[model samples]
Target: MTATAGAPAPSSTGQGGGPADDAGKESADTGPISAISPADSPVSPVSPASPTAARPLPPALPQTPTPSPEGSRPSRNAPVRLRALDGLRLLAALMVAAYHYGGRGGEISQAWGSSPREQFPTASTYFAYGCLGVQIFFVISGFVICMSGWGRPLRSFFASRVSRLYPAYWAAILIVTAVFALPWVAFKSVSPSDTLVNLTMLQQPIGVDRVLGVCWTLWAELRFYALFALFVVLPGANRQRVILFCAVWTLGAALADAANQPFLELVLMPQYAPYFIGGMGLYLIHRYGHDALAWGIVGLSFLIGQHYAVAELWHAPNPSFFSYRSTLGIVAIVAFGYLAVALIALGKFHWANWRWLTLAGALTYPFYLVHEHLGWVVVEVLHQKLNIPSYGTFALTILLMLFLAWLLYRFVEQRLTPVIKRSLTAVRVR
Candidate 1:
């Protein structure tokens, strides 16, 4: 499907209504990311907006969107697909879940204790490598967000983003907080104020542990979103300007780390910025249409980084110094960024479209949110009651957590998302 200005082009295929005639009618333009209503339509054959005699230029499309930013833009000529991107998300989420489960059972520490001559591997050196998943998420978010906001007014872009992210997050926070309060109702002691800080998403600033341990990452993501919004709002801002800003931030983060300075932690966390910057860089590469080479590099880098770089750096006797592993981490970030760009350019990878995997990927966020706490409870119950082996107990706990998360996503998240979207859109309209 091809879109011109804010209008959709006439449909070439006879399957749908004529593009010219349909251009004048409003329909729902659903894609991977945010949906566009007729008024926000970009004037393409697939656009839901009514047709006019003169189509607007591509750069002058409507500002408001109908869909959320989590999806990609709608295509005017052909259907857009990005299965590889979903696969990437699934991989990242699984890594995080596995990391948590591995740590919970002391599996990683046990692996670390074993030697080459040991009978059984004690710990997996790759335990810390799981954090790289968050980096992948950052990269994907940066690229998709940049694309979503292209040629749109900054305020509208910000509004759309706030609508997409905040509602689900806030609802999650409330649910988690209520769970925390259940112990209080049973006469257990828990700090209400501390929980309140987490609900407000201010725990990180106050040096408090996230109410939901995994929420710290959400804080970082939000910070990047705010920064990107500012970049877009700034006059004459473009991809180059964004790149320059990211470069400066990366350098500052490195310098801060080198100096053991705490100041940069206030604005930019050194270890984290590389992931976000890597993502933004990937977006720039994709916008420029350099996707194929980017993917090859990303895949190669991910393999080498995970197998070699991570092992070397994480195992170093003195990891404080600039080392090969750190260099590889940087390389991995670049590679991951390229991979994301390539995935976007391809629109969809066939392998990622497997129904089971896609369903698993769709439940990822809820899984990430609920798995750890619920997993802990399951492990406790099994270890204390069933006396299962440590590994067996851990594995069972993960299974239970996954099951619970699936239920939560199916019953709660799935039901609430549409309502939240509608409510937010109504508010926006008001």
Candidate 2:
């Protein structure tokens, strides 16, 4: 049920595998003010999952300088980077990691030799809710994708995404596959054909199995990019057009849900659309300054998002069998996620502008990619074999995951992104 493969049913539930599970699974910009700066300009590279991008703002919309921990804001026309937002990405990644490491004991119970709840009764209860972190990531994607993709032709937008998403992802797929190949590792190996298909990140649509459980979200992200490129970027995205896109997407998703049309719901993403829509609304406010219209968009998204959040909890596999999730708690967690981003959009967390936070953000996508199954295997070796305490195993696994993330980013993503970008651009010219 969870995004992970071979994981126990109730113990693992968050992102779904393939199109059906990913359709509305938890997982977001604004407006027309002189083609606001694209987040993907040639400044510091931002992760595809990260919300902050650096580009000079359009001369039309100048921002007044404000005091903050990072010092006074740069002139409005200067490139904008929300370092705090980057840090938030790491937090979201960790929340999901916590869910797997501390919250669930299902498939992992084989290694733990007992239930995780028994091992960390107090912690499991809190970490169980971390699954909601997927929604937070989705919301942030909406904001960053909209910000980064603004003012670009469809080709340029696609190129930026390819460069950002594929570098780390490719590295992750090979790395995880190699680990799974080890004779000692218990996880099953993905077939060679499936591995090749996964490289395209289209395995879900074509009904091929995912190499990494967490990769299910990538399908959602890819759909979002395609839709945005076609509807928003191709026609020229601005405040009015984007707002219209949001409204239309919201309505279309609702209709799809009502009609019980699986294909429509898959495309429209009724469950997940609200968060993405709301994020775009927040970005509009961030870029163009707050207005009733943007606020209304966000409000509508929250209403719709809340409905799906609770519904996911209720409809979860055998809700009565091992139900530890509360509907109200789910709602509250989702609201907290929205509030955190809203504060960032409003520039209320200016104090979070630490430089190292950007590094933390950069690690998020790679961290999320490598964490789940790999971490589970590591936990098995550490606790089951080494006889380490549960908490100690958790701590060591997180540190190792972070190190792997850094390696993926520094050695793989950093080296490969520009290469991929150039390759794509070269092909385009021909």
Candidate 3:
């Protein structure tokens, strides 16, 4: 019965009806974004090359990542994998799922015949804060995008994103819509036209209702991709330019917030930009060495990010349900997110270097896409009609979601990514 905090609903309120609504700098130097291919940056983590070597900026990246003299720079050919990031990505997805399932409010009582807070008294306290996991995801995206896009061309970056996001997303929308269409199901169904719009991932901006509540996050991510492709990848990234991009975005977001400029706020995303920017700064440190400028960007981003996080807590739906929320708690959680990524940037989480972590990470996107709406149905059925215990229903729902996520990734994503990437790569500008 909990509402998804900060997730905009397609309709006024309630679960069945509709879906809810929902960085970095661097210098100039380097080849265009596509210069590096999969071959140039290998995925094998067992290589002798250090993690720093896996994503070196193009040669002649002055101030940020200039080429070292012979034998100085890490070998790019070996491409070290940051398996830890995959683990973190999965963790973020789980956090968001937990929040959506148990944290928002007592409306869940309608389904379970008991308030979530009562059924999950101890866990709901922490899960209440899980909505912030979206911010953590944005941060991770910033880091991963910057790392991957470095030295790659716009087409390649575009292809990778198209391949990675759309396949699982398309699958989720169709599957969820089909579930809603079931006559016996309690949730509301979308019209064919709305379902079509959801496929485009432009539902939020174009005023079309979304098929899923989580689609809002995809819209934000698409914007971030466009911004990065235009400003960083197209122009050719270097340390100096990347740094400047982060700084300017930070300033623009601040001004937009101060002036109450809707247009600027829409483009700048004042509330979420800090996490992305911070993530990019962390990537800079990961690829290059730690520097004052990179650390400064990260520091500033955390400060700005925490401020908005607190604001979001205050503005979140159902104020009465979240009366226990505090500014300190929000700030601490956001800070912890930054710290986790910073440790990754500094290569301090090597313990997460398991091969299975890659599969866990791959499951994240599909898991996230399918979890929310369908999950409620599963929770309701298992707990109510089936007469399962509350705890058993919760655990089963999570496991079922995870299994479905894996199936989507294995059957749909793996099959479609290459086709999509190839199709996108074939398109050329005049």
In model 1, state the lDDT of residue 391: 64
Deviation in angstroms for 142 in model 2? 0.8
In what order do the candidates fall by TM-score, top score first?
2, 3, 1
lDDT of 1 by residue, 1-430 (tens): 1111011221111101100100000111111111111222212222222222223323323323324242334333322223344445555655555545442222222222322112123433343344445545555555445545555566555554443344334555566556545652221222566666666656766765454555555555566656767766444235456556665766676677678866666466665455445545554444343444333333433443344224323435453421112555535643664565455443334333444544444444555555544444454556645777666765677677667657755676456644554454454433
lDDT of each: 0.43, 0.65, 0.64
What tens digits encode model 3's per-residue C-alpha lDDT throughout 190-259? 7798889889878778776677777666666677777889999898766777888999999998999899
Rank the models by lDDT, top first.
Answer: 2, 3, 1
Error of 3 at 110 (Å): 3.4
- Poorest lDDT segment (10 consecutive residues) of candidate 3: 27-36
Which candidate has the highest lDDT of all?
Answer: 2
Clashes of 1: 42
Q: How much is the lDDT of residue 255 in candidate 2?
A: 97
Give me candidate 2's TM-score against the actual structure. Answer: 0.84
Q: Global lDDT for candidate 2?
A: 0.65
- What is the Å distance of residue 122 in model 3 from its true position? 2.6
| Candidate 2: residue 407 Cα off by (Å) | 0.1
